[model samples]
Target: MTQAQNPFNVVFVLFDNVTQLNFTGPAQFLCRMPGAKVHVAAASLDPVMTDVGFGIMPTVTFEDCPQSDLLCVPGGLGVAPALSDIQLIDFVGQQASDAQWITSVCTGAFILGQAGLLQGRRATTHWGFTSLLPMVGAVHEDARTVFDGNIVTAGGVTSGIDFALTIVAHLHGEDVARSLQLNFEYDPAPPFAGGTPATSPQHIVQAMQSRFYDDRAAEMEKALRG
Candidate 1:
């Protein structure tokens, strides 16, 4: 195929404790994009531990990875420490310098923000941490997926799927995106209509915030401040 026929050089930046789904969900779809070449990159070739008690092996090290056409960062409990990781942050900043699309899934947006990519951009992340986007100079958008120029940010976890499809549609066309949706049986029928804060019961939302995100967000804020 000619260069125009096969052009995407997609790269996913992996780190220890990353929420596996945040990367895997989007990878599942994006790997199928026409002419797409996906690269899983990290500091080394070691298996990166994930939040779900497993490890994802990296295909390339930061120094060896090719310049990305689409660069993605996925978030997890590891993000706080990752914020302080100078080498990792530098790698992200360097790849993004020439990437056609810059993106993050869930709290990974903060990583992008740390690299100075989200400044002045309209973005979004997991609803619980949307308020922290401002710390990175990002104007938070109230949506599952927010697109500003070539930067795309997705809400928590599964929202990466939507983000990927949106990118597919943008690059190829809605018809191609629709076909991939069908191929993957992308229809979502949840047992409950309560994914987001708005749709979820107020009590559950409060309890979750109290039990988890409240503290997590506090830590994220401190990390950003540093």
Candidate 2:
């Protein structure tokens, strides 16, 4: 179907304990894409629990989801267990077969990787797990968003917004994307200059890695191996 005539079916694969912002941030922007139809598909129609101590209701079951124009996976603490869910991995692989864009935010890249979609692709994810990309046959690209052909991977949670805006610009035009940015008042002025490892104080980065990411990365590595 022609772009003007086609409806953009954007599907987000949801799972229990997902980081809500990883999905919600992008969904908020992508939902505004002209003719966009957003579907939150999960293993069942039940509400999927998120890391924020709440749940997001799925709009459709995996069995009922439509062929997607864009397929996205969002990640959180649940990713380790999700890596072993055959049904979820299968759904991602199946949807990607026909999707115009296959994407992920944060450690959702691992889900894509588990589906064998990231093989030989340049990808990125949450900084903590970047080193593990090679385990899934993906080459790590140190960027907020990495596009390797039709596969787009975004780093961490908030980066999903940038990913969404980039996709909008690709499918629509700069004018439309720019308008969306303006509409959302997308200016970012963080209270601190420590968003990334390079920008953060050395002590802060070392502490975070030692206290959190070090173990988190090890857990992810174990999951990927399994």
- lDDT at position 186, candidate 1: 97
lDDT of 2 at 58: 97
Local distance difference test, each candidate: 0.96, 0.96
Clash number for each model: 0, 0
Ten contiguous residues minimizing lDDT sum, candidate 1:
1-10
lDDT for position 38 in model 1: 94
The superposed Cα distance between candidate 1 and the true structure at residue 137, in angstroms, equals: 0.3
Against the hidden true structure, what lDDT does model 1 obtain?
A: 0.96
The TM-scores of all predictions, comma-separated, are 0.97, 0.97
The sequence of per-residue lDDT tens digits that candidate 2 reaches over residues 80-187 is 999999999999999999999999999999999999999999999999899999999999999999999999999999999999999999999999999999999999
Q: Give the residue spans of candidate 2 off by over 4 A.
A: 1-4
Q: Model 1 clash pairs?
A: none
